[model samples]
Target: MIRLEALAKRFPPERQALQGIDLEIENNAWVLISGGSGCGKTTLLHLIMGLDQPSQGKVFLHHQHLGRLSAQARARLRANIGLIFQEPHLLQRRTLWENVAFPLELAGQFGRALRQRALESLEQLGLGARATALPAQLSSTERQLACVARALITGPSLILADEPLERLDPQNAALVTDLLRARHRAGGLTIVQTCSESPATLPDATARYTLCAGRLVPSGLLER
Candidate 1:
């Protein structure tokens, strides 16, 4: 579903975030990428999502080159991807339902269909009763669960999450992990980057890789 070929990203003042990174994620596969801080995990994800352009090389999403696509085309392509960040990044002014429905609303879904889709996603995460609450009103775990619900509401074919479970308690972290695994099993390509090598996140992964000094290297085979 996604491929990165010799991808490299360099920031101003000669800071290289990634160098010679090649990756491939097939449909329905769960890939785990682990790395320390400043190791370019988030930068790599941004390149794959077309949020950032690589200084060298190419990123292909569903066979289309991201760097070569027009802005409108990129936006359209991005609709097929769901991204969950370390922080939920929910809007303070928007209620939980509104935040989860934001993506569908952008796609022009409205009324019953939009509401139902958002509600269904929240229900899946056990957040149905909190739909009317604001982000600040919810607990940290609830906020993260709400983010997962928002990401899945679009039924995206690919999911790119960066340290999604970093701030959750053990119970909440397990819940999020299970949700991600279930989504991948349902045919979505899921790639997650975590700083720590937690068994909850690694056991079910089809493959694993590590980022070190801006390079992508095989970590080892996962048990699943």
Candidate 2:
């Protein structure tokens, strides 16, 4: 579970990215936050991931204050979180399987086990055959699916996806969305951000909210 209390973020001089955003996501619940570009949706996710510090207020991960933890502690805690970045962020030099297995290798699992887990994740994303291919050999959609495989390989307790369905064909977009929904249904907490909700992704959301000019708009039901 995660909780944010009066969270706010301001960049440099007068620009504000978020203002007093308070939210709670229960374990296994799926929440979607929608906002146009520059509207602070990604800023909110970064704060939650502890990649950026909150300018004010606090962020609690399962009741532990993020700002209160040391760097090493935060790094350890992050292993429990899966994140799909706005950019795929895949290493061009590594093959898809290697890229997906990198995190597990860093966490001390390698060789057969690492390959197996990475392959399983890839297969889940319908990318099994591309495991031996480099990033350059894949299409934009394949690249994104590789990123999703990388994120989910570790079986993280929570998933934070930033505009994950962008840059994909409708079929692929729906595939990825359904994967996330299935993960949530199977008891993994998920939080996704998009410029707007799509029919492919919003149907199973436990809660939904829109953000505008750094503030949360009133909650509304998203058509399934």
- Writing each residue's lDDT as its tens digit, candidate 1 over 61-106 gives 8899999998889988877678787777899999999999998987
List lDDT for all candidates, in order: 0.82, 0.82
* Clash count in backbone of candidate 1: 0
Which sections of candidate 2 miss by over 4 Å?
198-201, 221-224
Q: TM-score per candidate, in order?
A: 0.91, 0.91
Minimal lDDT window, size 10, model 1: 192-201
Predicted candidate 2 versus true structure: per-residue lDDT over 149-187, tens digit per residue: 888878788888888888788888878878777777777
TM-score: model 2 vs. ground truth: 0.91
Residue pairs clashing, model 1: none
How well does candidate 1 score on lDDT at residue 16?
90
Return the clash pairs for model 2, or none: none
